[model samples]
Target: MPTRALCWFRRDLRLDDHAPLSQALINHDEIHCVFVFDTTILDALPRQDRRVEFIWHAVAELKETLRQQGSDLIVEHGDPATLIPRLAHRLGAHAVYCAEDYEPAARQRDTRVAETLKQAGIAFHALKDQVIFAKDEILTAAGRPYTVFTPYKNAWLARLHPRDYATWESKTLVSRLARHDDTLVMPSLDQLGFGDTDLCTLRLPLGTSGAETLLKDFLERMDDYAQTRDFPGIKGVSYLSPHLRFGTLSIRRLVKHALEHGGDGASTWLSELIWREFYQQLLWHFPHAATTSFKPEYRDLAFENDTARFEAWREGATGYPIVDAAMRQLKRSGWMHNRLRMIVASFLVKDLLIDWRWGERHFAELLLDFDLAANNGGWQWAASTGCDAQPYFRIFNPVTQSERFDPEGHFIRRYVPELATLDKRAIHAPWKAKVLPAGFTLGRDYPFPIVDHAAQREKALALFGKREG
Candidate 1:
């Protein structure tokens, strides 16, 4: 009897460089590809979510690519824990293969799926494709996971042999993809309970082809990534976050390119890629941080959940130009600059004195590039509540950050156009301008600063001091 396998596509959407997909092609005589809409996640999302739309388009592209190679993707709707088992039993598959997911909920879902498959006498194989190193792969000499980033990065570097970054070369053997016995058509966005958003109008690329377009363009400017990545006005950054989040591109290939480049820019960019892995392992080790503060001591520190102030921050009306611009960028587009992400997050936690979880949840709903681990880790870092977080006293001065990274206010002017007429000097702190520009009323045109930075800093210190001490 010939062995048949089902390749379940989750975060790893592309066919090339996918470890589980590659392994399935070799071990089985026939392969059936699948992607689940996963109503468990989709049912709770807004009707006009960009993430659902992005996944829909990416799955469609993958299906077309598979169709060209003699097979069709089995795109299914509903809960995967129940549906995957039924599909495998119906197809009489010997085993199911998929990429590993580290999130708590995903792990639970995978466990259920595995149990179901096992009960039916079918095997389940999950391969690591998202991260270069994950879950204690880069442990300390004592065999414990490194809590700090420097040591973790150092250990990660020591363990990164050439084989670790080698391409899987999966595409060449995709001829083994099993042809679909039934003619099953993929459903449209409306069928999935999602509506069209600015994703198409924004002209963001979709699937493998889209990732290649971004990678090629980024390589031309890789040398300048160090000096330019901080500025959000121009296209200094490689707009590949969404691609990485959705796994349209291979993490192994990305790391290999950075390793080969051998420059400060590439090394810095490589560190960022490692940081993504670092956060993943962090979540895997300390799942409590997903909801509570990583440092338990910080959890007792009361965080004010100010409703009106958080709304102002969300709407980009906090009266801080840099912070407002970053929020506006996130609201208008489904993305925000990384540097601005830090700045705005600091303003929210330290200046506005709000809970980091609230900000993290808002970003979860809005950011197309949002990964639960990365988003939660970043919010905790900004709020001084996670492992390896910034010192609680070292609050970011939003005005200074704006003046330094976005000098001449190009980024601010682009996103917060109400401050466009203000000169560079006044743009950073428009309220402190010696003279207001004509018709630029402080409260009427733009609201005054929501919270005084100096006062808020003192209040934040006192709050932490009273509880943390």
Candidate 2:
């Protein structure tokens, strides 16, 4: 009897540099790859979800890659916890292997899968692949998770070894993959109860090949990342986020590039990567933070929770140029600039006095690169409700933020074309413009300011200040 194993692909989508899959290939005589669409999650998403389409494209490529290797990927639509064990038994596999997922929901799913696998006398292995350091791997000397980022980052950097980022080799062992004669058919998006989204129309690339293309492009501009990353107008930042999100690109490959380059730009980029791990660890240690404020006092902050303003914010008709541009960019592209993410989040929570969860949930629905940890961490940081968050009093003045970061209004004009003719000075706040472009009328062509920032800032301050600490 052959020592067979099932290599379950989830967040870690690609075959190359895959840790658990590589480990399985190294140890087992025959390895079968599988990916479950996980209807439990998909059923909750919108019909025309970009993420579903993106995953569909990636999965198709993955299946083809395995087929080219004389192997096959069993793509199924159902709960992975149930599907995995059934497939393991059907394939007569001795074990199942996959990368560890840190999100609370994923942890629960994996736990159930592990219990079922154990009942069937099969081994289950979850290896770390996504991050350089996972939960409790980079903790402080006191044996506690560091909530503060700088110290946590320093600890992470201090503990780092070259071995940590080394690529896991599996391609050389492709012959170990289980060769099956059965014809494998991948299901269409419609068949899976999902409509095709405009994911192809966007610039975002899919799968490992696409990730490689993006990385090659980003490497050229990496040296200037520190100087240019904040500006929304120019091609400053690496757009490899979606690839990173789907595990099309290995975090190790990216970290290696950042370290080998050795500059402020690379260092800054690396810190951002570390921040990702920080949030992951935080989420693991404090799952409650996912649904409520990390700081208990601010959990019940008196937010106005104005639905009308939120709707306006969502539609990008808020009459604040930068905020509107960022929101519209997200609506149209399914991606938003990092700086703009902060600005709009602040505007949504502080300026509009809505709950941070509102903006976080909205981002989760729209963002192609949305990760639970990053999105939640970012929203809480903007709203001053999470660990190491910005001070509650520090509200972003949208007009000034626009003037400073998008001084030329290049980004604003790209999405909010109504303000294209306005001068750089006036483009940041078209409602306050002394003169309007011919045929354009405030509140008619463009909306008047939905809520006064100055007035709302005080309300926001009062909202947070009045919280019973």
Candidate 3:
């Protein structure tokens, strides 16, 4: 057993159900907890990034929780590849442990850190903490990685045991954490070269307490999730994606609840969680999908990459009410309803014929809950270039999606307030409304549709066909 170990928190921010933290506690006599605001990643982001703000507050809360238990987090700002090994060496820790990160860059950085630690005769360990099933944990009967989701989910469900979702209760051993001076202080957001975001106004509570609050609320609404999940205007889905992304909530706790409840709502919610896991495994197995389409045949697919249309889409001036409203939601709140995400993604790829990478990168910059694997999977799915993607011919009609999912335009009105006075029918497609709302004029109050959906649908189909054929 190691005499001293450093527990490095990354994506898994909480104190509970954490394997690395628990392993450190079980194997070492003294544990030093640290979180690095990795400058390598932060240096490229805009100072006003919501993700940075969320992480800053979340880590702050984690530190406070530790302090209450006679331990404090060592918060540092530097590149993890360099800083982690140096910190471990300085502290004379026998080993360094961290939550496993599977993204390409993170994987590379972890490898470098591990090598550096090895050079100093210190061991490095990474454990599965964030996901219920990781790597090839849920493989097919043939012992191959499952590419498609339903089969993967079926295997996942079959293989899942009580042990899979068991809690680690790492905090029960919190006494083992290395004690720190009361004077030790964490850096402020300004000190980290980041500014404030609208996270508070958006009511995105930070940290473990916030995640518990969301989980409680979501359980009450879980019964309606299956029926209501696709409706943008309704409060149908659990708004816990950010918490899940940052590991504020344990996958075990969530899955155990759903499996035990055994209802359509819980079951459906579980499937969504499964979808998150599926994307993760896909990225783990096919890291190239991070930057290119999963299907190699579609890798060089021609896209117009229309700059003007993409700019309009980004600015929420697409003239398609649903797409515009969704874009507005993304810009304002750093989140878009899941249904809206699909609709807007289709509009960007099929209608504007823009490269899906553009929208994926845009979302990466804006979403508070952005996960590279999930974002890439979602964008590729919409563009019909990923595993189990939408049929190439089945392009989403933005107006119809608006009518079906947001008929009352309540969601639209909230984001596109300019369309508030228009009748619900007109709100979705103002140009086609027999009589425009009394005060509104096309191209003045709102811009005209950038492109005809039908024409663009044909163009997109032909473009993809040319490449795929």
Candidate 4:
């Protein structure tokens, strides 16, 4: 009759370097690991969600891993507040352990689960695992969370220690996993009310294996990351955002690898990770940023919500090839290059005079790597509505962006097939081609520019001006 403990798995999916899992193995002789599909979240998602498919595949892999260890993952599809406490009571476990989540909905869910566990006389323990430093860890001298990124990044670098990069050894404690008389059955995606998503067909190979594959591939090209990351046509960027979002890879190991072997590429990549942490902390300190701008000054900025323009943008019919290509890529794959994300977001808020929140919500629904903090921070940054944001007047010229980043138009051609035949010089602005290539018409083949970029820039400036004055 060893003391029983339930380790609740959330975003930190892997068994390695998991604080809650490690602690469970250390303290409890018999540890039962469980994952709830979380209906509260799933019910709100679209039917063909790739993110959900990714999660389903990841969970299946996790169960297989546990089975190989002579144990099994107890999978449930319901609200954790009800399911966790009920399962703990059924197992007669004394405590439940998990990693902390900072998102508003997740925070609320955890609080509810904690209260239910408390009433049931079971201890609920949560540990920091997702991030190296979180909450108020790198606050200003006056004890406030820093609004700007540079100072916060400097403090984060200064605070880094060897111990922080060390992995928590859960492999040594594998024998502690709970063995039940009856093995628990895991549910299928259909049972959870989710249909087969595109992710399944893509065969992205979820869980630890997928993370490792992407990591190894990225390491091979890491030295040239800075040179290649900006160009969407090339494999310049590491396609690890989805893995990071799902916690398939350990952040400590990523940082350690970059620091030891990555040179200048590692330096730039590490700064990007720090930016991620900064956004997470920003959300923690200012949850209001989810609904409104971070800089209160830009809250009242006017947006001319033209649904026609937004539809054009979403359908990848925007005459600006780079912006259109990025949007199209997002539609096809749940992932987008970081550079493209910035470009598309800037086009939405600055060029179209659309509200940043609208674009933010759309991305949240579509992006597999959509974390609230990063998504919101990115949208506001593009719209010049956040602290340390780009100036409102410095709107991106989509043609120039295409010329500079996708010089050969290879990326644009891949996604926007209508522009495939056009040469490099004309691909950026197909609408302005002197001779309309046979069967290529602005309204017929590819839609015309939704709104004139130059005219809209002036309109956006005036809108911000009115708000400031």
Candidate 5:
């Protein structure tokens, strides 16, 4: 039998720019690709999860890609620890290779899988393909993780070299793909106890093709990214976060594009990508941040538990136009603009005095691009509970935010269509409009602002004060 290697596909779903796949091809004559629909993870998600559907579709596409290359992906539905080793044993593969996963749960799962493979006398090799820089690659002078982003980013830039962005060229190894005597089968979504979700409604294309489309589109508008990214109303931002989250797009390719041809906009966009890396490292260094505040001093900070208010906020009836619009957008698309994400997060924790974890949990449930590191980083940053967070006193005025970012209320109108008839001036604050639309009333139609922003701001400040005391 030819020496066989198992290429276990994780987040890095695509065939191109894949380090593990390239490495597997380099060292082995026959490469068997596999993807496990991890039940340990899927069991916790809602049946209608868009993320599940997205992954399923991406996997389907990848399997097809492999099939075109005269190979088939072996799809399994079970715990990865059990499934990976079992599959490797059955295939009698010499080694198992995969891309590294950074999330706490993922790290744990990978560890267990590696141990199982080791016990079975199979070498497990994990390559860094997800993020450009990971785990102590960019550190402070004293060899500690940098809590702040700027210095870390600067160091990351300084450490950057031409070869860092070079492609792994997996295409050269396509000939090494294992061909089975009989056709390998892919598990149906229902076999995994998952129902068909209307993910197509979101219009998010799946797999490498989708990533390429979004990247190409973003490159055209890369120059204006900095200028227009702040405005939620404009089509200035790249909708590549979901792609990045799934590793459908390679980070190196993205960084290379931004550096080589991307102008000012690309530079700004690249920094955002670096921020993602910073957060990933943060989570890796401090796994406690998953449950507790990154800044320990803020962990005991009081949060008001107003379920009614939180419900109103979640349902986009908070009466703050920008906040409402953003909430509605999240509900509809399972995605939100980065600027608006900060605004809504701040509104929940600072303005409403709610716990940041509550908002974080909600985002994790709803966001298609939900990665624990970036999600936690963003929420903590907004809540003033993370390293390099905004000061507690720096609460966003939702009305002012609406006026600045959604000046024409285009984003607002798109999500909150009930306020579409209102003029631009009144759009941000429909409750304050003297002459309400023919059949509109604050309490009846839109609902009043759940709590007075000024009152809640003071309450949040005092709560933090008490915690400090």
Candidate 6:
């Protein structure tokens, strides 16, 4: 009797360089590909979610690619824990395979699915694919997970072999993809309970082909990434993050490219990739960090969390041009430049004295490439509550950051156009301008700084200091 397997696609959306998909194709005589819309997750999200739309397009592309081969993708919209077992049983599959997801909730969901699959007598296989190294793969000499990133990154680099980054050849075994006479029609966005979003207007390249387009373009500028990445106005960074989040591009392929093309830029870029794995492993080992401070001592620090102030910050009327611009950019587009992300996050936690979780949740709702590990890690870092966070006293001066990173105010003007007429000097801190633009009244046109940074810095310090004491 011929063996049959079901390859479940989750975060790992692409077919190439896939671990479980390739492994299934090798071990099983026949394979069926699947992607569930996962209503349990979707029902909680806003009706017009960009991530859902992005996934839809990516899934459609994956389906087309699979259709080109002898196989077809089984796209279903429902709870996977209930659906996977039924699908496997109906298809007469002996096993199910999928890429490993490290987020706490996802791990729980996978556990449930695995138990259900086992009850149905279907073997469950979850393979590593999202990161170069994950879950204690890079640990200290004492065999403990590294809390700090530098040592973790060093260990990660030292342990890396060419085999670790080698491409998993799944396409070669495409012949094993099971051909079914049933027509594979994808559900419409409406059918999936998601409305159309501005994803198309954002012009983000979708799916595998899109990832390739961005990778090619980024390679041409990768040499300058280190120097220019901080500037939001420049095209220094690869816009391949969405693809990375969705696994349209393989982590190994990126790591391999960075390793082969050695330079300060590539090394810096590679370190970022390493940081991603570091966060992934951190979350796996310390799941509590997802909801609370990574450092126990910082957990009880008091935050104002003023709802009106938070609304102003969210609407990009914080009266701090740089911070406002960053928030507005996130509001208008589903993404923000990384430098701006840090600046805004610091402003939210330190200047406004709000909970980092508030900003984290907002970003979770908005970011096109929001990964739980990265977003939570970043928020904690900015809030000075994570394992390797910034010192609590070292609050970011939004004006200073803007002048340093976006000197010309090109990024600010792009998003916060109300300040466009202000000269570069005033653009960063328009309220402090010697003379406002003829028609631009400070409070009327743009918000006054919601809180005094100096006073708030002292308050933030006291808040943390009291807790630490």
Global lDDT of each candidate: 0.92, 0.92, 0.91, 0.88, 0.89, 0.92
Q: What is the per-residue lDDT of model 4 for residues 198-303, given as tens digits with 9 covering 90 to 100?
A: 8756666578889999999999999998788889999888888888888888888888888887588989899999999999989988988989998888987768
The 10-residue segment of model 4 with minimum total lDDT is 197-206
* lDDT of candidate 3 over 1-469, digit per residue (tens): 4499999999988998888999999999899999999999999998888899889888999999888889899999999898899999999999999988889999999999999999999999999988889998988879888888899899988989999999887766888998987657899999999888778888877889999999999888888899999998889999999999999988889999998888899999999999999999999988988888888888887789989989999999999999999999899999989999999999999999999999999999999899999899999999999998987789999999999999899999999999999988989998898988677888999999999999999999998888777
Compared with the true structure, what per-residue lDDT tens digits does model 5 show for residues 31-96? Answer: 999999988988998877888888988899999999999999999888889989999999999999
Q: Please say which candidate is ahead in TM-score: 2 or 3.
A: 2
What TM-score against the true fold does each predicted structure earn?
Answer: 0.99, 0.98, 0.98, 0.97, 0.98, 0.99
User: What are the runs in model 6 whose C-alpha is more than 4 Å off?
Assistant: none
What residue pairs are clashing in model 5? none
Candidate 3: residue 178 lDDT (0-100) = 89
Clash pairs, model 1 backbone: none
- The lDDT, on a scale of 0 to 1, for candidate 1 is 0.92
Candidate 5 local distance difference test against the native: 0.89
Model 4, residue 14: C-alpha shift (Å): 1.0
Superior candidate under TM-score, 2 versus 4: 2
lDDT value for model 3: 0.91
Candidate 1 TM-score to native? 0.99
lDDT value, residue 179 of candidate 4: 74
lDDT of 6: 0.92
Q: lDDT winner between 4 and 5, please give it.
A: 5
